[model samples]
Target chain A: MEEVKAKMPRYYLAWAKDDAIRKKGANGGFVTATLVSALETDFIDVALVVKKKSVYEGIPVLTNDPEEIKECSGSLHCVPLNLTKYVVEYAAKKRIGLPTKPCDARGIIEQAKRRQVSLENVYMVGLNCGATLHPLRMREIAAYYGLDPDSVVREEIKEGKIFLVSDEEGKEKEKWMKIDELEEKGYGRRDACKSCVTKIPTMADLACGNWGSNDEKKTFVEVLTDKGETLFKNAVDSGYVAIEEAPGKGIETRQRIDAGMQKRAASWKEKMDALKALSRSERFEFYVGALKNCIHCGACKEVCPVCACEEDAKCTGLYDERDSYAISMYNLVRIFHLMDSCIHCGQCEDVCPVDIPLTLIQRRFSERMQRHLGYTPGMDVTKKPPLYETELGWSAEAE
Target chain B: MAEEEWEPKILAFCCNWCSYAGADAAGLERRQVPPTIRVIRVMCSGRIDPAFVLMGLLEGADAVLVTGCHIGDCHYVNANYKTRNRYEFLKEFVDELGLEPERLWLSWISASEGSLFAEMVREVTEKIKKIGPSPLRREWKK
Candidate 1:
């Protein structure tokens, strides 16, 4: 560990175990403490879909129910367990703080390259996601077990099964619960997360979790970037956490991540195949159907990193005094406006309530972008897009 | 907007010293060609941006035709390279948006190629007419 710390300081660091538990929403009191820390620090401006009770002393905090992140169609301001926009925006504006997950880090990188945010002063905290449960379904499952949704303790998911800790802290935790138990109890997840890829937050600077932990008290934290390393080292030095060499624990966590990724990839392949089989006209119909149910919530657009529209307050282009334009022209314009800039982060899909399958539509367009212009957004900040330049080899008057 | 629409609306963004001169020669020859085309002359084809092509399409033009100096013959040494690459890349980009790639055309008509200029316009006009109007043209917010 010392050798690694000395040699790869630029890309690696160590995280104390406690930081990992807080990432998982493990202890409500601990989570509240961390959330308070996140709130008080002006270093990172946080736009969270948080309960009013979660409010803190200082920070620019945008409040909404965290569950709102699921039904959003246009953009994602928070949720997806990553909180990328908050991390990146705050980092660029203020500097130094943690984003939620790996995917959030990717979103931050994409936004930064577009000059939407700066990456220099951000801490990308990664949570080891087994699978993101559909929020409503999770609530319903809690109800089925005679547990109030608000009273639900830590909900741990592993090996495709869900274990809900509904008892009070002094009560013995419930044993492992099966996905079938939730189903038999009449609860299902949001469709988006059920088909989501990326369980380990691959873009995070520092990923931590307890996916492989036998005890809920200990967490596995692995530093994947210099920024993460610096913060973790500081935390250790400041006596905020206890550090040690947990090589075996680290390997176990990594193996679980690998396994989870394989599962996610398989599911993604199935969803993509289903999407590909749809005709172009049918695909258009799908988007139209999705748009019809839109409540002008602006949740989707709000969460979008590509959505830099300042006029969102008025809902000018996407929403107007008249109903959001009936499907055709408005949607086309909106899609194109985002086409060149969208990073396909899937936040919009994750947030949409109507289950619009936004990621599917964006992926379809991204595929076309790759095939034609040979351009892929969010690949690198330095390389200019092919569309920004002119065609090569052909003369202006070759006819 | 007709299927057999011959209103070429050809946007010839040509370089001043080269393709623009060649365009002048085509007119001076008294060639009986369709006047449906609108030519915008500039100092160099290299000055054009892909955004201009997008703007032209959005503005109801049937086709955007760019003409520049042939390779090794640019007025601003290697200026033609920028034009060549820019248009080629944009051509693919337009196609990806489900737009008719044929609607956006690129060619090299040097100052010496007066006859080529006339022939190119006639050919591009016919091709664009066959393709008809751009979908974005229909959606244009009058």
Candidate 2:
């Protein structure tokens, strides 16, 4: 126990001490308990959590009440909202705690690098994620399973299968389908989630999930940073959570799961990219054709996690409605600006009103530039974006 | 009338400290510079945002030349280095957008290099002439 405490990043199996929280949360409510404990102890001024509205929806809630944090415990697999912007806009100055998926954690880190949020004041309790389904896709899936989409009370993903529970006249019915089988039918996870390789949120303060825990009542938690250790210790000392050292076997199993998910994601990325076969001119036409439908509503820019420029952004400021160019300057400038910094979160695609395939367009442009520069955005905060770097610091060979 | 001989419209961004002076020097000397180029002089090359280049391309400039002071010669001290960095980004952007590599050119011209400035304009004109016309150009009906 002393040796485990001595290490900076320690692994443990933890559960909520409160029976209600233990029963309410997935994987023993370790995250909920920690946030509650932190809020009660004044360690953090606010807790940001996703309040589940339904099996298909969740809304981000920022509260200082410990009970509110307890009420917002469980996971929602279908609601793919990113909480980074909320944290920046609402809780940037306050000491805040929130549950984060890999993309959320990465986005927050990128925002912090851009000086939109202060990292010292934010504590991220990261959840391990395989992928998230679009809410519309979930409804389609529910109908495909012959269940009423509105009647579905609970949804869960476990062991490569998605389980949906529905209640009719107080009688419960359950159905499940394998994720791979459903994906073959062109409906499973969002394109961004399917291609994302960050299965574990190592960039966050702490990473907690159920992949390593054999027991369904406990969470496998890895203390990744000093802030994570403080949060864990506070929860334990305050009698909100109970912890036990994780076994070596559990750790190995978690690593295996992460590796498997990453391998699948890489293959999915290659398979989903339809532009690979097109010649340069064809690719150009494809980009112009896809982006021409943009109404310039600015929804994509509003939800873009990596974009911190807000109202004064050059993309919108310089764009002219009068220019009848093949592609609008708005899109061209945005693509150029995000070439180094795009996290490929697909939020832009999700919010696009014209049904533009921004995920593919952004991925095609930014991914190659990122690969060429050998810089991955949102992974490290100390490394400034390459676009902002000087020639002496970053010299690319002229072609 | 038969279609007039196609001439490329090349837009050049010259810096005030060195490249703009070099353009003036090219006129002072007897060296003949191509009539195909139109120059926009800025305080410094670093001020040339990549967006401006994109705008020039979309506005039907067959080629955009970014001419600046050589490295370590910027009056603002290391500002031209930023131009070099941004030029790299512009290079990748133009290529990915299906523009020919010759459509974008970056060169450093000192205030005294009148012959070099004239030579660059001649070379850029020849390249743009070879490429014909930019696809971004929109033809208006008479």
Candidate 3:
């Protein structure tokens, strides 16, 4: 485990062997097929999937049936649910499999570190992500372009553009808008996704996406860990999937795309930071102005994926609504607790009733502290968070 | 027409075995201690959670001081090491919250270090005085 294998990363051009699933699933149905196969073979007792309800909405479904897994094919870019808590609360004891975005996988790993869930019983199939759109923003974009939001049939983000296909009178019309252009008008991806640098779920057992695939029907996959290998080997053995060694060009292309996305994310981090231009006193005013509107609703804490403290949360217990400080004890305690483990999932901002730009606020406090500790949270389970360590693991403390 | 001069309220969290005794020692030695400080004593520095510091700030304390036994000298084994670890988080947090970096402090003061305790208090008072009132402070006149 210590030695980084020069060729240890196993790459494959993977596709669902079943014709029906391949047609229904975007790219290949490898994730769906793998989950189905795992369940069929009793490799996992259950699977968690976000069953799409509409183009802009989906509901998380926990099931042990292979048929249900097949129906849950395709990705929902706007379904920003974190599957970690679902696994912890519902499937913590059972061997289970689930597809995950980078942030979801990161949250799960963090939960494992906190002993909230046992990783041995969980199998994560990671997807390479380019940011997800906020559902409310989708409606705004629909209205801006003069289309009925409910009539939209399919939405896909590809080649720096968002494609919304609408069905009217048995005919489909498509409209394309560049993500950058939409974001400039304040109507694209969420602020958290824009600033996020970890686009690939490296912490997951296996990572899969369409970035480097030469064929539109195939997925490029990298098996990251032993559990990932078990899932891959099971699917191939069960004849549920087909795999070929990924071409060198495909691997190079994947790296190139990932690097370009990270570069864009860096600029977005600068552009979207509300605190960047403010003077220290101005920054003070900004926080007070934003956080004071809080009605003491615990929605932000409730939606936080990395937070393991549920009913007995210290933030809620210590909070008194009457304490009329510049910032509330609720906000203060929550921010402090999340300083080390916030994955910047943006769920808190999405759920806030007062619409506090909490994505930016939490990021402002956490980014500096994480960098100073030279520690990145949610990447590995064996390494404890620096906040919990007795002495920080700094290379040159004197320096 | 002068209202009472606004004095900085500094909240100091002292560990019972060490820094609290150090404060008592300061009194016994007749060292000049600042009246601005209000000390809250805990059993050990390890018991001081990051929430406590944030709570102090939210309550309108101009500054909060985290005082503990020196690194290797925890009354409970290896607890002050935990305190030092958490101090790193509080330092960054106070700075990022747009508070002056001088608003939060961590110093290791043993029971014997009466003079150092007195000096740290004086230094904190002067720094807070320059920074003026905490923005969180409520003013009924306003």
lDDT of each: 0.56, 0.91, 0.88
Better of 1 and 2 by lDDT: 2
Q: What is the lDDT of residue A380 in candidate 2?
A: 87
Compare the candidates by DockQ and give the number of the best one.
Answer: 2
Ranking by lDDT: 2, 3, 1
Question: What tens-digit string does per-residue lDDT give for candidate 2 at A1-399?
Answer: 556567644889999999999999999999999999999988999999999999988999999998888888988999999999999899999999999999999999999999999999999999999889999999899999988888899999999999999897788889989999999999899999999999999999899999899889899999988788888899999999999989999999999999999999999999999999888778788888888899999999998899999999999998888879989999999999999989888999888888999998888889988888888989889989988887636665432
RMSD of 2: 1.9
Candidate 3 regions with alpha-carbon error over 4 angstroms: A1-9, A394-399, B1-3
> Model 1 over residues A135-174: C-alpha lDDT tens digits?
5566667676666666565555666576676655566446
* All DockQ scores: 0.22, 0.61, 0.60
Interface RMSD score of each model:
5.5, 1.9, 3.1
TM-score of each: 0.67, 0.97, 0.96
Candidates 2 and 3 compared: the better one by lDDT is 2
Candidate 3 at A175: error in angstroms? 1.2
User: Cα deviation in Å at residue B94, candidate 2?
Assistant: 1.6
The residue-by-residue lDDT of candidate 3 on A1-399, one tens digit each, is 425435455899999999999988888898988999999999999999989999889988999988898888998877777777888889888898999999989989898998988999999999999988888889889778877887898998898999898887777888999998998898989889998999889999999999889998898999999888888999999999999989999999999999999999999999888689889888888888898899988988877888988999988899876676778888888988888888899989998998999999899988888888777889989989888888776522210
Best by TM-score: 2
